[model samples]
Structure formats: C-alpha cells, structure tokens
Target: MPARLPYAYKYLRAKKKFPHVWCPGCGIGIVMGSIIRAIDSLGWDLDDILMVSGIGCTSRMPVYVDFNTLHTTHGRALAFGTGAKMANPKLKVLAVMGDGDSMAIGGNHIIHASRRNMDITAIIVNNNNYGMTGGQFSPTTPQGAKTSTTPYGMIEPDFDICKLTEAAGANFVARGDVYHVIELDGMIKKALSGSGFRVVEALAPCPTNFGRANRQGDAVNMMELLKDNTINIAQASKLSKEKTEGKTVRGIFVDRDEIGYLERYEELCDRVLSEVKK
Candidate 1:
C-alpha cells in the first residue's frame, strides 16, 4: 500500500472522504499540502486555527481539513473571516479563496479587509479562470486567453493579485506557484507568521477546464507553463515591463508592520470606557 499522509489523522477528516473531488492532474492538491505543511511547521494548536473558504474549487479546502472550518457563501469568505477574527482575536483565521472568488465577486471585501488591516491570512488560488463554474473567464484571466465563456478570446486585462493586495494596504503580500512547492510552503509560513491582513496568491493549474480550453496541453504541460512563464519579483524589478510582458511575477511584494484592526478597536474601546468612568 502507498505510504500514509505525512500529516496526522487529526488534521484530516474521515478516510472515507479520501480521493478528493479535484480532477486528475489538478494542482490544488499540491497547494493544499503546502498549506498543511505550513501550519504543521508553525506548531499551532489545531483548535485555535479556523479555516474559512468561499464558493469555488479552492473553497472546498476547508471541508477536508480537520480544523475549525467555515464553508461560507460565495465570495464572502473574507467578510466572514473578518467578523470571526474581530469576535475572537485569539483565533488564527485562514481564508482560502479561488481567483474568481477573491478577485471578482469578493473583490470589495478583499480591498476593505486589507484597508482595515484585519488579522487574517488569505490564500488565493489563481487558476486563471473560474475552474468550478464552467471555466468562465474571471477577473484574473489573462488578456486574450480563451475560456468557455470567451470562445474567441478574453479582451479584458488581468489583475495582478499581489499588487492589488499590497496596494489595498495588506501588511504582508506574496505570490507563489504550485509548480514550486518548497517556495510556496515557505511563503505561506511567512504569511502565517505575520499580523494584520496578509495574502498569498498561489498560481494553480486547472487542467480539465482551463488547460483544455486554452490549448495548454495536459496537466504536466500546464505546470511547466507556470514554471517557465513566472519570474521572481526581485529579478522582474530589473527588467522593463516590455521585457516582462506575459510573465507572472512571484515573490513577496510587501511586508511591513501595521496596526491590526482588532488592536485598534480594543484600544479605542479602552479609551472610551476610561473616559466614561471619569
């Protein structure tokens, strides 16, 4: 028999749930493993960790993980996670959202959450299209990429998720690819270690829908494309935009100290209470 999972049984649901819903050659599994490994490395108490997700392929993550999970409404994972964090500042809130879930319908929540500097770690799995919803062209779908909804080709520009989060005021923001598991894991660990709103955009491949439609060959080919088309942010800085066109830049874009929402709220409450007593 194949060796068992590296994680303890407590970290997963019943074995019956094994053989996840993701299709063959899906990179979401690799992203999931990186997440589990990041949490394990942190040595956090499972009970204190709350995994939240919105509707999409990546959203299905919380269902399999054995932590305190909340599978919420579509494009609202961050909104719910924000409330959860504010209610119990002790909880480690981790939100897993797909590109469509995070950037499209949920875009407003993401920006506001970052602006408030909420203490939540968000992992956005960008497969370039809406993998779960008929492989539709999402907000992050590259310009001129063909999808089920864009048979001719998409005409809109794609949003750089890392840049969006950083500009929105997230204290920590980074990008990683499923093809680079080690680097992905390290970035997740770093995001988890930081306070205030943080985001890690993980580029995953949806071979069945996105790959086939885009003529990207099979899953292996898709992975290779991800590896070859991406450049580290450090190296990208030295090159002109023309030279970096069509390249997905990956690396920590922003990391700095900021006052988290909960901290600020608590201070305000204390001040108000003292003044009332006086």
Candidate 2:
C-alpha cells in the first residue's frame, strides 16, 4: 500500500468531503490536487481563503475545497473575485475557471482584471474545449483540432494565455501542464504567495471531451504530449517562433512585483482619512 501523507498533508478540513465530482481520468483532479496542496503549503487558514468559480467542469473545483467558496454564473468569476478582493483586501481570493469559461465567454473580464492588477489569483484550467456543455471547439483549441462543433477541423488559432495575461499587465504569470504536477503545484503556491494579479494557466487533458473527439489518444498519451511538446521559457527565447513550431512554452513566463489594486486603494483611503482628520 502507498504510504499515507501526514495529517497536515492530507488532513485538510475538507478532505473527507472531497474526492470531488470530476470524472475519473479527468485532468481537473490533478490540477485541484496541486492547488490544494499548494494552499496547504502556504499554511493559509481555510477561513482566509476564498475560491470563486464559474460554470463548467473545471469550475466545480471550488465546490470540493474547504474554503469560503462562491460558485458563480458562467464567465462571471473574475467580476465576483474582483469585488470580493475589493471588499476584503485581506482575503486570499482565487478564481478558478476553465478554457471556455475564461478565454471565451470570460475573455473580456480576464484582460480587464489583469489590467486592474487586483489582489486576486486566477487559475485557468485550459483543456482546449467546452468540456461540460459538449466537446465544442474553444479559443484554446489547437489549430486543425476537431471538436463536436468542428466536424472537419478547427481553423482558428489558439490563445497563448500566459503571454496574453502578461501583456495585459498581470503582475505575475506562469504556465504548467497537468503532466508536471509538482511544477504546477509550485507555480500555484508562487501565485498565491504573490501580491497583485497573478495568473496561472494550467494545460490539462479532457479525455472524455477533447481527447476522444480529436483522437488525441489516451490520458497517458496526452500527458506524454505535454512532456514532449512543452519547452522551457529560456529555451523558447533562444528559438525563433518558426523553429519552435508546435511547441508549448512552459515555465514562469513573467513575474514583476508591484502594488496590488487593493493595497493602492488602502493607501489612498489612509490619505483621505488623514486629510479629513486635519
């Protein structure tokens, strides 16, 4: 039998209530495990953490974790998380969303949230399809990939989530696939520990939806693809875009420390209060 982890490791307040509703062989479990472990490593109290999720398979993550959670409507997690952070700046706000939920319907909110640099962490689980409603094509689906909506093949290009977040002024940005569970966990911990808007885009496998439809092979094969196709950020910089064709650039893409939106607001509030007292 496998050795069990210590109480602090697996004895999170919500463990017994979890093992969640996600399907077997789904990558969401791996992502959730990493996030939960990272939260444990941070030694953050469940009461101090708030998990906000939008509609989708990945959105169900907040439901399992024993945090103060909000299961919001589709594409609204960013807005809700932003409001929550603005209201209680001390709270550790995490918005969990899926590719279709974040990049498609929620795309506008994501760009603006990064622009605002709110004190919130956005965890985007990119499975490259509309996994819940159906295996429809999504904004992150690779070019020429087939989906229920795209019987032939997807012709549109996929979104480079990390690049987009960084370009939009997110203070911290990172990318890791489900295949790199430990790496993904570390990245999540880093994002949570950082101030300001941080985005971690996790490339996960949707075997039931994306994989079966695209003939993308089994779960293990999908993970192997993650291992084979991903190149480190440093190596990616050395290669031309064409030279690194078909490669997914992994690792910490960007991390720049700056005052988060809430911190700035507090400073302004202090100034106003002092002036009023004067």
Candidate 3:
C-alpha cells in the first residue's frame, strides 16, 4: 500500500473541483497551497471560512479549493468580503486578489477596508504585471519594468502594498514571497489568527505573461530572483542601507491590537436598544 500524504493534503485531497487555470510555474498556485496548509495547521473548520476573490489570474483560486467561496467582479472582492464579515462576524473571511485586481481597480476598496479595520485577511499576489487580461503594468509593477503596455519601460513609481496598507491602518501587515514557502505559510497563518483588517502581500512570479514580456526566463529563474532580491526584516536591520538598496524586504511590518468593526457595530446596536428601553 502507498504511504499516506501529510495532514495538510486533507484539504487538497478532498476537493479538486476543477483543474487549476494557472499557468505552469505561476506562483499563484503556490500561494494557494500556502493558504491551504496554513488553514489546516490552524484547524479552522472549512465551513466557517469564507474565501472571496475578484477577477484576475490569482482570483481564480477559489475555484479549486473546498471552502465557502464567492467569485465577485473585478476590484470588488474586498467590498463583498467586508459585507460578509459584517453580516456574520463569526465567519473567517479571506480576500484573494492579484496585484492588478486589488491595487488598480479595487484600490479604493482596499484602502477603505484597511481604514475600517474590519475582520478580513487580504492575500495579494503581486506578480508585477496583470496576468489575466494581458501583461499590462500594474500599481505594484517596478519602475522601468517592461510589459505589453509599457514597451518603453514603466515611468511611474510602484506602490508598496504592505506600506500602503499599514498607512491605511490595517491591524496587521506583512510581505512574503513564494520562494519562501515556509515563511509565507507562517505569515498567512499569523494573519488568519489575528483580528481587524490584515494584509499579506505575496510577491510571486508570472512566468507566463509578466515573465515572458520582461524576458525573466522560466519560473525557476524568477524564483531565483526572489531568493536573491528579498531579505527578511530581522536580517535587514543588521545590514547597512547601501547594502540593502534595490532589494525587497519581506516579513511582518505591523502587528497591533485594535478593536474591529463588528464590535463597534454591536455597541451601536446596544446603545439604540437601551435608548428605546428608556
């Protein structure tokens, strides 16, 4: 008889609703696996977790996983997730989006969600360019990067997803790359275990679209780039500014204790009831 697979496969082992639509070597699949393993390690009931996604390459994640899922319009995953969390605070809500889906069209929704500090965990896969609609430059695409839309090289600066969310007041914010799978898993698990709005900006490679346009070679080459280019927060503190220049920082940037939206809403409802009683 064949040996049994690890416990985490319990999630993947059960439901394969469809063949994943992601391209070979696309890191979105790795991100999805990290999510599943993290959730499994946490032992959260699948029924109580609500996975939501917007239109994009990464947004197709919910199609394969066995969880309560909602596939919404482009730039609206957070909007729908916020409503679900408000309606049923007991449910664990997770919003998955690609860099383009969240940072471009859904920009306002993410900012408001972070400011609202509601109970939601956002997993944003930043593969530089838009993978689904075309290899177009996105808000997170690096300056001077080549893409289908920016043949002359992108001119504008890119938005740092973690920093943006932190400034917007998310309770927890972290940056992780698909190359660091264990670290990514830990970050996602920590984000899931927290309250208020949390965001995990996952830097993944889009070898199919983004990579092809930029001539980043295959998925292995992109993974090597991640390994060399990113440094963790702990090690970064010891390095000089010049040494770390042009390198990406990965790890938890913010973790704070703050009241979530549901508690405030409940308090208002109680106040209204007490006023009527009087």
Highest TM-score, which number?
Answer: 3
lDDT of 1 at 65: 88
Candidate 1 lDDT over 1-278, as tens digits, reads 54775565658888677778898988888888988999999999989999999999999998898899999999999999998988899999999999999999999999999999999999999998888878999999988889999999999998989889899999999999999889999999999998999999999999999899988999999999988999888889999999899898899889989988889999999999999999
Ranked by TM-score, the better of candidates 2 and 3 is 3
Alpha-carbon shift of residue 8 in model 3 (angstroms): 4.2
Better by TM-score, candidate 2 or 1: 1
lDDT of 2 by residue, 133-201 (tens): 879998998889999998999999999888899999999999998998888999999999989899999
Residue pairs with colliding backbones in model 1 are none
Q: For residues 1-278, could you state the per-residue lDDT of candidate 3 as single tens digits?
A: 45986765566525546567888999998999899989998999988999999999999988777789999999999999999988888899999999999999999999999999988999999999989877899998899999988999999999999999999999999999999999999999999998989999999999988888888889999999999999999999999999999899999999998987788789999999999999
Task: Give per-residue lDDT, candidate 2, residue 109.
Answer: 94
Clashes of each: 0, 0, 0
Each model's lDDT comes to 0.92, 0.88, 0.92
Between prediction 2 and prediction 3, which has the larger lDDT?
3
Candidate 2 segments exceeding 4 Å error? 1-19, 235-243
Q: Output the lDDT of residue 23, model 1.
A: 89
